[model samples]
Target: MTVIQWYPGHMAKAIRQVKENLKLVDIVLELVDARLPESSRNPQLEEILQNKLTIRVLTKADLADPKLNREWVDFYEAEGQPAIAINSNQGSLKAIENKIKSVMADKLLKRQEKGIINQRIKVMCIGIPNVGKSTLLNHLVKKNIAQTGNKPGVTKSQQWLKAGKTLQLLDTPGILWPKFEDPIVGKKLALTGAIKDTLYAKDDVALYALEYFVDNHPEKLKERYHLTDDEINDTTVNLLLNLTKKMGFKDDYDRASERLIFDIRKGKLGRYTLDFVPSSENDEA
Candidate 1:
């Protein structure tokens, strides 16, 4: 397995800025990719947000297994964490607003008792790179205020945006932790575009994706590439080479690897969930 590590200067600065601005916000909206709920979360951000009111926003639900989305939400909610899964492009965001208000109800009531009325909830939006943080922000505020891209590290700074009349969102650049302790976590991030393409070997992640599909969604993989049972059963490396030849790329395995990765990201094969909720907290290791 290839070791994946990418933490640039801007991310370090973003962490400092997040800590500095933590006092200004009433709540935190931690965004994560729906397919990789646990792996996509930044442990560094978790440390910075210590005891702060935070909601887990699982973005890109459309590209992830729908059943897993609900299960992940249940897993978080069962642990007493506020969480919701949304496609951001189409899912209703009313649930997010309602959850925020409900969580802050006590704080709001105290302010109301002191004669403060209609105070907007201040929230900080954060997530790993390319996990749809900016896209979610744009939908929440109903504008293209934050730059959206298919690549990582698009948003470089933080800014505030109004969501309707009640929520004020602080949009920050996607922040990844300095290191990934688990290699699977790194591969999952690389497969899902959370990590930049240049940061990891495409063949490594493509093989990882191929193995995942072979185990979990062989039919989709076979159908997508028109592979026979014997072909599908081939070893991962041989299958990759076969795919390269079938795609008319000849010996350019990198091109084939890139195609497989792009297809997975674009949902050409099918929706998938790389992370699963452990049956119990003790089972997490």
Candidate 2:
């Protein structure tokens, strides 16, 4: 289960469908995982949505480090992009609505000046699977308009939900990039549950995720699992097995590893965000 490969023909068809439907959308709300915003973004999306007003919304903010999430917001804002960090379940909708309106303010004004008042700004929600697109939709409309599940790829088709007076959301099925050029991006996405777990083995993905945390945020693992940094040696499986043994799981390293993976995905490992930008020096190394 090394780096689960999920190249589905339907993804390409979905891309085509998005292109066909883009004409109907006034703005694009790109949903990204707050923990893995850089990796979860579909690279081709910018190209397909060229010239469209795009607002970047980082979802699941409660599960990510507040400092890092603010850094991401600042980074995007500096680049002339509107970004908001919102925990959808907590009724944080004003920030998202403000950003959308800010981006579409001119367009809305133009319509008003032309006597076409009360036109709803149509927004298409797009993102990789399990990035909380559906959750945000439900939070905005205050209803379960789109089907949602803990697993990835739950929303198979597009649906529209009218959100209040001036906004209507077109929910699209989560789409992945055609090719994950960066292996680290793929691994981070898989580790965070943005990609389907069944596509890869639990132990292997957990090892990769462990290595990532150990290398980037070793203190988080030490603090949460009560394991010394040295204990997180290169052999993640063995480290997890030992930790599980101490945590009261006897003679079940495999089961313990599965639980460890689930804990990481569920933010039990701590509020950590993977790198927002790839380090070129790392890639070269």
Candidate 3:
């Protein structure tokens, strides 16, 4: 598979902008996709956000495997950090609000002690594009205050908005690093819409997706398209061929591949986690 990399001019600007404004916010909400938490995370986060309180917000929890979601949360918390999983759904939003409040409790207490009660908590939301930063912002405020789109680079600039009377949120453009040293990171990012579609080969991505399910969620393939054991265990190319035939695409493997990707993204196939969430034994070691 060919290596995939996409770093737009705006993303570079966003990196600088985030650093410039890092000290202004009380906390940094580092949003990432729940499926591939490590891959979706910006590796430069610690460098840009030095000495800043960062709360990892794993967005799109509804699209990810729930068991793995819990594991990933435990993994992050094991490092003495706060991690939260949320989606653009009911019940989860309230949980997100509570998490933000919980993290801000100490700062809020300080404000109260200084005779400044009801101070608005300032938060800077940063993450790779299309990981639901805008969605989270809108949910927190209960309105479409920021633009929302499926594609990346949607939020080109930063905008501040109020989430209730006590919280002020700064939504910044999704920033990706300059390069992806590991090709798998690019593939994972591309598979989850973190990377632009034009940069990667969809056939290869679809093949990887197929291999992932074959190894981890073979039953999902059976439930989605009813593939037999042979077809499930076939080579990536053959699997795509089988899918093409089953979907009546005949020789249109590209369309079939795109369809599979769409189904995976939209949860029509099944909930999946692209990365491994380590077990307790691995964590303790």
Clashing residue pair totals per candidate (backbone < 3 A): 0, 0, 0
For residues 1-285, could you state the per-residue lDDT of candidate 1 as single tens digits? 575576799999999999999999999999999999999999887679999999998989999999999999999999989999999786566888898888888998999999998888899998889999888888888899999999999999999999988889999988988888898899999988988888888889989998999999999999999999999999999999999999999999999999999999999998999998788674965
Stretches off by above 4 angstroms in model 3 are: 91-93, 279-285
Worst 10 residues of 1 by lDDT: 276-285
Write the residue-wise lDDT of candidate 3 on 1-285 in tens digits: 675456778888889898899878989889989889889988898778877888898888889999989989998989877998877543255576678788778877788899997777788999998898888888888898899999888999999998877678999999888788888788788888877777778888898898888989899898899888888888878989989999999998888988888888888877889988766686898
In model 2, the clashing pairs are: none
After aligning candidate 3 to the native by TM-score, how far in Å is the CA of 9 from where it should be?
Answer: 1.2
Off by over 4 Å in 1: 280-285
Overall local distance difference test of candidate 1: 0.90
lDDT of 3: 0.85
Worst 10 residues of 3 by lDDT: 88-97
Output candidate 1 Cα RMSD: 1.8
